[model samples]
Target: MLGVVRTLTALDRLLDVLPVLADDMRVETRFAVAEGSAFARNLADELHRCQAQVVTWDEATGKDFDLAISPSSNGPLHELEVPVVTLPHGAGHHKLRATETGVAQEVSGLSRDQLMHEGRVVPAVVGLSHPDQLAELRRNCPEAVPRAALIGDPCFARLQVSLPMREQYRESLGTGRRTLVLLASTWGRDSLFGRRGDLARELVATLPADYQVALVLHPNIWNKYDGLQIDSWTRSARRGGLILVPRLRKWQAALIAADVVVSDHGSLALYAAALGKPLLLGAFGHDEVVPGSPMELLGERARRLQPGDLRAQIDAARPVPGHRQLAELTFQDRPYQRLRTLIYQRLELPEPPWPAHPEPVDPFTP
Candidate 1:
């Protein structure tokens, strides 16, 4: 059995990549869950056809596995006895320290020295999106380089379901006018570091009479901001001619329907970038590590949403070029081939046939 630990942020990537492993290998894959989560249940349902086992810490104690895989860097590393592989999590901009005792590897450019300091003794592998990240990994974690493989993110291997429910939801909300989708994520209060409810109210007050706005509240915010009624807030906006969508059948579907998106530095922004949706990055608090901010990576496609800069930013964003091709390149359309081959080589399993197409380009560059 191969043990896989996953984080909610990386669930889409995991689901896309792991199914290929099941198709090619004889080993059984079981997932270790941190807690019961809606995303976990969704993942289980998605992978049910693959026959992967879902296990908790108590049930995983005596389980045997040849290798361990973690979808995010933040998952508990000490749980598995076998070698571990990790996907890049968080900013993916800075180099993390690596260690010696436990083997840690990344699909981005992180150096061995950096990895060593971060408790990752293993080398970092280059994934599809960032070749620069691979170079950094080689520079920082040289020891783990040999084991490093250049497979892309698993999420990119399979195509995401672009459902037509966006139109239905829009009609349900009566938001036929210009619409903006706000994906509000909770990075803890300290990290969220931006405007609070007052900010939302300010934006609502300032929105043009013709424009309608929808707020997709983060699932975590319900618990964090206890007793806060998203419906009431959205309804207030609705009365003002701006329609707020508090409930979504599928988050990605909502993203597809949106003309523009406002979010902080979360993975959902990446999805918006992939979909060629104009982005407005709200940099409320993460000044220390983010530097120029992840929105800078989107180049001219997005701008930082400031207190009074909303109108200008939205105006500037109107002519922004979409990068659907770039998204396809970074999130390779069929990444399972590369991932499967790399895993086989690492575990000394026989290599499988390569897919018909060559590798995709990096979406970050022209």
Candidate 2:
């Protein structure tokens, strides 16, 4: 049995790890989530679909579990008695330097993610994707990074193997006849397509019918801005041939099917480029308050665009050498099993049979 604490994007990371744990019936999982997060209900649905129980985290509850794993640097971790393992939540991958300017501050922010939860070190060991990330952390936050464990992102492990989502992606989103384009957007006024006159609508409005646009929105956008800015474009775009990606599973499928990617400097860009997709930057990367990321190494390969000039190429942009290198830097091969192994090693549990489900029914969801 294990406990998990998730903040915003870590819900998808939790989804990635659940498949490795699913086949093991002996291991029951419980997730502790903040009561007030926007996506709490969506997470409830997702957790039920994944067959895990949920616990509402209240600081005064003082509940203790056998082991706890948190997937975010910014989770609601407080006084807990068990050994807590903190998984990477898309930060801590670059060298750090103090700065006040936007660009340098962006670089500094990567390693120095404003140590959250009252400056309490959350994890007994911090999980990392590469040794380089560890070194970067050591130079920046020596106290924390020294306990780093090189566990590649379990999410990008799918790219290390043959894609399983190709057919389903085509089935749900489209037939394979069109050139697939993925437009992944984050939320807030800082988002890529937040107030930008609907890029998906514009893409389908401008691009020829030989293309397909799949837009996977961040869950926060789905929850917080539901009937507001998100609705402004999604319904209209769907009417105009945009394939609205619903959840992380389908989002991964879209990534598998995508030939070209348009995103901000968010996790989607990192995951897409980590899987070797041609990337283009929307307005989000160029003018955002979200700290810059090492994932931008691959994002910089593409042409940056303002909201008005969203362009499409007849042929997909070729992923450069830097894309693959940064991807390899971000992901490890066989990560699900490696994460499983690490869990067993850390928690001193017996190894469970980690088998591949050739046709996993909804994979992480019911």
- The prediction achieving the highest lDDT against the true structure is 2
Error of 2 at 33 (Å): 0.9
lDDT per residue for candidate 2 within 1-366, as digits (tens), equals 455644346676666666766666666777766454445566656667767677756532354466677675543454566666777655334422323453343333224453324565556767777666656566556667656777776666654443665666566565468888888876555567665547788888878888888788876676665545555656778788787776555566677777788877667777776666777767554444322345546555655655443453425355645777776666665566667777877768888755632232231111
My TM-score estimates for the predictions, one after another, are 0.64, 0.81
Error of 1 at 152 (Å): 2.4
Model 1 scores a TM of 0.64
Q: What is the C-alpha lDDT of each candidate?
A: 0.49, 0.62
Give lDDT for model 2: 0.62
Model 1 scores worst on lDDT over the 10 consecutive residues at: 357-366
- How do the residues 18-71 of candidate 1 rate in per-residue lDDT, one tens digit apiece? 555544546567776644333344444434544657775666645466666655
Candidate RMSDs in order: 7.7, 4.4
Q: Per model, how many backbone clashes are there?
A: 27, 0
